[model samples]
Target: MLRIIGFLLFASFFSLKGQNVDFEYIDKVYVPTIKSVTFHPQGMGIAAPVSDVEGNIPLLLTFDELTNDVKRFSYKLIHCDFDWRPSELMEMEYINGYPEDNIQQYSFSSKTTLPYVHYELTLPNRGTRWTKSGNYLLIVYEDETEKFPVITKRFVVVNNLVQIEPRLVIPANASLYRTHQELDFVVNHPKLLIRQPAQEIKASVVQNGQWKNAVTGISPFSFRNQQIIFDYQGKIVFPGGKEFRPLDLRTLWQRTGQMADLIRTRTSTEVILFKDKLRGEEPYFQNRDINGRFFIETQDQNNQLAADYAQVVFNLYTVEPIYDKDVFLLGSFNDWSPSPEYRMIFSPEEKGYILKKPMKQGFYDYAFATRAKKEEKLDFMETEGSWYETENEYQIFIYYRPFGARYDEVIGYQVFNSKR
Candidate 1:
């Protein structure tokens, strides 16, 4: 009886673990030790993890494991709906070649106190290729009987069946003209028979590749002569948050302007930045930034294996701690997620919020944001003010799924910038 009960319990554990995955828009790290997960098109260090369906443009996937022992890892792709839910199509409908393949590339860290292993893989190799054009969730898991999930990243595959013309404009509304930017666009599906566009078509607008706050389920305003118009003046608006704060950790030997101290120990290095003051009320000034992006690099070593990890300490000085809302650090390094893992702790002694996390050697752009309890929406107004002059990237994705379709097809895609 004891043996049977133990076996049943073990089976139940796997069943539950497999059922509770929060398949969402942002990158997810199931294992705590996995750090610095990045997925972008090859050669483009800071770009959306999007690729053309026929370009054979492989994406670069890389991450580091804190443990010393190298482990077997494999990846599989799952088709996702426009809202990021798993689609009805089976795995074979979207992916060609083997369903899962072993990750054959990895290297151990060198010349660093914190021992780790770096893994890099160019996607769409001989092992696997994609056949559909839509949102996909790439899940990396252990190549074992249990198939434990290690990390998951979101990306898009566009078929380019339709052409999109998108542009950014200053909101005509006097109230929002200076603080918000508006988007106007048209989708020309000359090749596609887009009937019932208001009911059959939906679109999503993302700011800087951040899907967490992306505006989804928007339908076209009008359809005429195979052209779809999206003219939601005030409805299609985004807060023009100030430029991202820059952190230059490219070289630890020489401190940067905001860097307060660099502490080197026998095992690891600590990069501390001088306390940051709240800038919500300050005037907007032109500042150089990567629009909340990061690129890994080690100036001294010049390779992934030689790039060491560091404990980055962030100190935000606030006059009074926000008693009602919680603050978190947002950056491309962490998929701009406002999760508890990036949550800052309030230190009454310092009268500010603080957080520390492990980061690979790189130049990073980040900003502090706040959110209310039990809310997923983040507020940057308390920490960083909004300005129409802020530079930002906009991604417009158009999905089409007629009656009885199994999945949403990304027929049109375009990128727009607010700088101009």
Candidate 2:
């Protein structure tokens, strides 16, 4: 019976490949050689991948190619609607310059055992710039054609025309008050003209930039005097998950956080993290985390080119295998998307869930979660427990499509904290 269930899980995950990642618009790396993919505002490597429509701080996209060979890569941005589907608007409508251009800025690795090339591209550079504010997908491909995409990432361009007043609300339900958090917010657009304030104004609330758990296309709860409110009783609630477990791989010389053993080779380094435990039954303890984000850096070098990659082996020790669900590693490094590559398999001999992944030297924050065999939604109660007092980052995006607008316009964006 275990074998039969395992087969079903594997088959379902593999079926997602039929979407053809080369054309799919998502935050994913299609090639095995790409590592440490990040898209964020310029000068701020750890910020969420959001930029103002004014283009003062262009979005920066960076990645490491785990090879020495030089490859010609070109990139393009696709304007998407509120739901992430391509707007299908002409290229001239959303882009100010050429729709596609080559990625010419890169640096080769220096004094590192594992050779890699660091590539950087700033949006709104000399080549291309965004003309409209909305959802966007950055596609990097070979030979100037998106049909051979190597990586894809999602970023947002917003032109602030409204004010978002967000407040973290405690759930009123007895069962949810201790484990869940909710958002109560309002949008006031004083400058923009709107015919249907409740019908046209929509909102999306995202927690920790993870779209898998985001509430999208939300209608206004009430409206009064150019203000739209969203107080969903308990519908806009999220698990107040505990602070992510910290992992420090800044250097291989000294022991770091959770590093049980380190094996160094002439060409590579391997890390074995101490076994992780289920924290659901334990009381929540306050800890510092990057809010589930990672930044690539090395103490041994001044720049990113000298950072090395390590094969990390993670072991999660559960009382027994979760026979009904599949486990996966969740973090900003993978855009919090659970896939076969990040899935943890149960090891009989080790009596735990184990996953091996190659990651660049950096400070990372991560947690483990599970997905049911028949559903895509992930649950965290089995590994990292939830608590109402946990600190978390919330991103609120307000999109407008007044009556005749062809595409959704991102009129407001806000990033706030629960404990603030």
Please give, for residues 14-60, the per-residue lDDT of candidate 2 as tens digits. 44333345477778887888889988888787788898887887888
Best by lDDT: 2
Listed per model in order, the count of residue pairs whose N, CA or C atoms clash below 3 Å is 1, 0
lDDT of 1 by residue, 192-295 (tens): 89768988899999998887778889999988999999988677888888999998877767778878998987877898889988888988888878888899
Write down the TM-score of every candidate: 0.91, 0.92
lDDT score, candidate 1: 0.84
Highest TM-score: which candidate? 2
* Local lDDT at 120 for model 1: 86
Candidate 2: segments with Cα more than 4 A from true spot: 1-21, 144-147
